[model samples]
Each structure stands twice: as structure tokens, then as C-alpha cells.
Target: MTFENTKEFAQQLDSQDKLNKYRDEFIFPKVNGEKVIYFTGNSLGLQPKRTKAYVDEVMDDWANLAVEGHFYAEKPWWDYHERFAKPLSKIVGALPSEVTVMNTLTVNLHLLMVSFYRPTKSRYKIICEEKAFPSDQYMFQSQVHFHGYKTEDAIVEIKRREGEHNIRLEDVLAKIAEVGDELALVLIGGVNYYTGQVFDMKTITAAGHDAGAIVGWDLAHAAGNIKLELHDWNADFAAWCSYKYMNSGPGNASGCFVHEKHHNNPDLPRFAGWWGHNKERRFKMEPTFDPVQGADGWQISNLPILSLAPYLASVEMFEEIGMDALIEKRDRITAYLEFILQEIDKEVDSTFEIITPADPSERGCQLSVLLHGEGRSLFDYLMENGVITDWREPNVIRLAPVPLYCSFEDMYDFGQILKAGILR
Candidate 1:
């Protein structure tokens, strides 16, 4: 699809977009009575207009039904989290039994690691990309330390070539081979938060398994942003937050995946909670723990109905629109955004450099720009003008044109606003 760097061309594209109507489904941030051009879905997505009604439904149940709501209300609170499995499984490409929504992202990561990341004296090294999200880094370090290992000795970090922003897949594969017998786990982000680079999860998972290491992914940025096949990839486990591309409310309940191969394994170690006990005897409250079958076995507590409400609101939209439609628009709009930026670069002799991969398959909706000369000042200029974008530490500015809410015209207007900022 050839793109022209003009508002008329942008409008033409918007006129034909099937997902254009979804923009109205969300409530956008406004300034001076006008909606801001939101390009920060990688950080936090806009609230869906229906989120309020969904939350209120839960509130209404509590108001009238009181304790009886647990068993008798509409959509019984006892199995509230269960409904999410099927819809979220579609979003992340896993079986309903393989997926469950429960704790927040990091907590779920720790829980999964308890069952998957079994380290020993000879094979305990964890391989990951350098400068993974702070939480991930901390989790890795703490987990290794808990097992009487030093982080420096047990962690193998994959770094890029000196001038490159993204880690090459070859380098990642080689790290698995190099670590070989000592590599106990390979845990990395599916879509890097800072670079917006979508890692090859399938290839990476295979390589890690070949090296006799358990594999997992933190799909915080990738879950709803890219096409994932966690089950097909045979990933041991994975976790993701619902706030960003999932459009669930901020710090909402997160989702997790566990392959079916691990389902009936009674020997697998986990931090058991009453909620994860076998449903037949869960109310019996026996002294011994008998775990549930699939990913539901990892759950520690009953569903947080209020926090889970927004996810229901969001996943319904995902099921309605479907991922294929979402990915199609994502590719087109992101390419147009890249084209607009390049045109702006030519027009102004721009000093900014795109740090994300040029290949569409290697990225999601985000484009991380490295401002060479004037960095934060330019970011501030756009912010003051009401162009919402993400600014990472040091120098990267990320602009994500989410397919659900961002229009092609928004990208055009951004280019114009960027040109004005550069000229000023």
C-alpha cells in the first residue's frame, strides 16, 4: 500500500478503514474541549466507553444481592474469572484451559517461575536480553538469589552490536547454545518496551528447549499488540498485563498461560492457594492440597470482580473485532506513520533516528525514535501541543498509532505538528 504524506491522502485512508468506527468506542483524553491525538497505547490504552457500564453491573449485583451474589447474581462471582479464559485465550492464541486471568503481571511471573524455573547446582543460569524491564530483571535476580546463586553468575544477558538497537535473533540463539548445559531458563520480553522490537518467540522457545532450558515470555507489550501462538510455540509459560493494548483499566488483573503438557503433572512444584485446589473438594478445605488441572491451578485467590470487570468489557471488543482485523490495520497504519515520519525528516533535515526494526513483522504499533540533537525539548514541544506520545529515558520518543483508536489523519496532523516543533 503506497502512502502519501498529505492530510487528504490520510483522510482517504481513514474513509476506507473498517476499524475506524472503534475509535468512538473509547474515551480519549481531551485538552481545551478537543480530543488529543493519543499515540501512547504502548504505555496505557484509552478507556473503552463501555467500561463504566461493566463495572457498574458488578456494583449493582453487590448492592442488591449482597452475599448471595457469590452464587445467585448474574454472572456468578464465584466463577467470574473463568469467563475470561475463552476470550483471552483467543487474544493470546492458547486453549481456554491453558489460559487464566488472576494476579497482576509480576506476581504471576513469580508464580509461574515457582512451577517452571527449577534450577539446580549445575544448571541454573537464566538467559535474557540486557536491560529487560526493571521488574523482570528484579524477578530474575531475586529468584536466582533465593536458590543460593549470585545474579552475576546465574544470569546471561544478550546484548546487541555496539550501534544496533535490537538484539539479533542469531545472537539470541547463539546465547542459548553457548549457555548449553548450564542454562536453566530463558525468560525475555515478547515485545521490548523500550525498543518496540518484537522478539521471535517461537524460534527462541525452540532454541531454549533444545538447550534443556525452560522458556517463558513477558508479553506485557506483545499480548494484544502482536499475533501470539503461545500454545503452538510450546512456550512453557507466559504472563501479560491487560492495561496496555488489552485496554483493561490501569493495573487490572493480568493473564497467564500454561501448556497442557503440564496440566496433570502432580509432581510440579507451585505455591498452592485454596482457589487452585481441586473444585470437588475446594469447599471441603482439606488439610492437603489437590490442585486443579490447567492454568487455573496457578490461581491463588478468588476473582477480584471489580478489577476483572474492565477486562470483560475489553475482551468482548477483542472477540468482536478479532485479531486478524486488528493486525491488518496495525500494519497499514504503522507503515503510514513511518512514511509520514520519513517525509517529515526529508522536509526538515530531521536529526531523529528510528530505533525499531524496519520490517513490519518485527514490530507492533510502536515506532521508537532516537532524537540525536534536541531530545526532550522536542518531546516537550509535542506534549505542550497535546500530541500524546511515550518518552523513554535518555533519548527515545515512542509514538504508537493504535489501530482501534488512532486515525491516519491523526498521523498526518502529528507530522505537521512535529514539523512546526522542529522549525520553532
Candidate 2:
């Protein structure tokens, strides 16, 4: 908790990091055969070394017994996905019955929207932060249009002042107040992808509920990045992809949450599949659409074991280190990075601003850097030097040294590389 300069800070912080051992579990990205400092878990997480073995277990099951693999595999590919529920539930702070791993992010979003985004005459509007992930924007538009409403009229996008990065909590509540009776659904990212701001979900959900609106969160960046208490927050529903912070590999399956109170909604119209049918009667195919309780009821397709396995492995790591230690490490490393970036800006004549919140509690691991005139060149230079960060459009570079794998030495080295690049 105490330190000198960045190097001393990093060294002392690393020494104190309870989750430091988790860094060895992953296969960091290699560029030209060198392990690059991967500060882009906001974009994609490093692959856990156990991923192959996990995949092989499923593979062996399929090879040894085709249909029998369903119930007889090593982990039993049939209920294999369910094995992840307990751990995943802990990661996102939901009950096992309220979480399910299935489908891609946008698809799951649409499915959850089907259940949660009920729009009636006087109460037919959706509230979200402006410039939400393009996928969410598209899904909202298509969902509204499908229901015979123009998206522009039905959607309200909350934005920041000129040149600002995050949407303020007060602004969010004020907008909900303005929308009042008309706001039927409030869907926003728990952590904004670009700014790395972790929205106050408890407050947001409370305000939405007070306004008589259903609240949902897109935890694409928040899940596994920060500690969440979705159930306690009384959030109506939420969904997240597993590839980035969850380390589930690219295009991995997504997870969803529907509160236990809404899980038995016999009246909620949903785009259902047989997979969403009552688990006991699923194979019977007796035809009644009895949905499983909680978030599992929102599932629409069979579990993809291959993709889900990587997530399972990562969640296993999460269970070992726990979210508390993970978040502590994350905040320290991110602060180090932010300090170094600011230091670099001080030494230079150019303008580079950190758009992410200065408070660690307000963010996850990510820091969004807004560069001025030389942003692009600085980005290219860093990339060419094997400093792996992500560039969001219009002059913002996003960096996230995930606590599970990124090293303090890694952050220090990244700072050095970044400084050298920007100074030149």
C-alpha cells in the first residue's frame, strides 16, 4: 500500500500482490516469438495454459463415445457447462440458478431483451449511455424496429459534456427522472468499454426500478474485471461475453442473469428454444415450454463446450485467487500505469490525457488514454515495439493489464516502452 517511484511502487506492490501467482497460469501473447506486455484484456484476455487440456477432455469424450459423450464424458459434456455455474456465479455475484453459459454476446443480449425489454404504449423507451458497444446499439435498434417503433424515438442516449469521457452518476439519475413513466427498459454497460468507467449499478438499478423501469446491464467489460453484486443490487437482468476479462478465448459463450423474482415469469414472452425448456423434461420433448428457474430460463441454445471450457478453466483460477485479491492487484497496477503515463506527458510537450476515471474504484483494470496530435504515431510506435495495447478510434488507446496474468514488471516495462515511444 506504500511506495516510492514507479519502479519501487511496482516492486513493492508486486511483492504484496496476493494474486501474483496467477500470472503464471496464462500464455501471454507473443509477437515475433517474444512475449509482449498484453495490456488489452479489455479487448482479449491471455489464454490460460490449461485451455488445451480442458479442450482435450471434451475432445476425448467426443472421440471415445459419440452420443454417450453427452452423459458419460470425463466431465460429462451433457452437464459440463453446468459445472461452471457455481464459480461463474461467484465471479459475477449471482445465484447458480440465475446464471447460464450459452450463446454469443449479442445473441444473448437479444434473448435477454426479449424477456426484459417489454415495451408498452405509455412505457416504451430504452435508456443507455451514448456510444454503447456498437453491437448493443444495433441490437436495441433491431429490437425496437421489430416491435414497430423507430429506434431514434424509442431510445435515449446519455452522454457527457464536450470533451468529457464518463457519464456522471447524477446525469444518469436526472435523465431517468426526465424520462419518468416512459422509460420501460434501462440497458447500459456496467463498465464502459472505451472509458473503463464502472457505472454504479446499485444506484442505477434502484433509480430505474423507482421509475418503474426494467434494468439490464451489459457486463462485457465489467464481468471478471470487477467485483459485482448483481443479485443484491436487484438488477432485473444482465449479460456478458467471456472472451475478454473472462479469458474464455475469442467468440466464447456469454452468460446471463435474470433475477429469481422474474425467473418464473410464465407471462414474459421470450424467443425460446428447446435448450431453454425445463431441464427435467428437456429430452422428453413433451412440448410444454416450462422454463428453468432464474437466468437459465433465458438460454436459447445448446452449450458450446469448447468455448465454455476455457472460461471454466479461467474461473477456476478466479476461485483460487478470488476477486478481492484480483481487484487489489488490478488497482495497483492500473495506478502505476496511470502515473507513468502522466509522468510521460509531463516530460513531453504534446497533449495526452487519461480519459478513464482517476479513482480506481470507479474503473476496472482498463485505462483509456486520449492522445492529442501525435496519438496515432505513438500508438503505432508502441505496437511496433511489442507493447500490446488496443487503440479505440478517434485518438483513444485502451490498456488493461489483467490481474490474472499481467506482471508489475510487465507494467514497468510497458511504461518504459511507452515513454521511449512517445518521447521519440
Best by lDDT: 1
* Cα lDDT of model 2 by residue, 313-358, tens digit: 8888788777888887788878877777776677776478888999
Question: Model 2 off-target regions past 4 Å?
Answer: 6-9
Q: Give the per-residue lDDT of model 1 (tens digit) for 25-131.
A: 99988866779999988889999999999899899999999989998888889888888888889989999999999989999999999998899889999999988
Cα lDDT listed for each candidate: 0.93, 0.85
Ten contiguous residues with the weakest lDDT in model 2: 1-10
* C-alpha TM-scores of all predictions: 0.99, 0.96
Model 1 alpha-carbon drift over 4 Å, by segment:
none
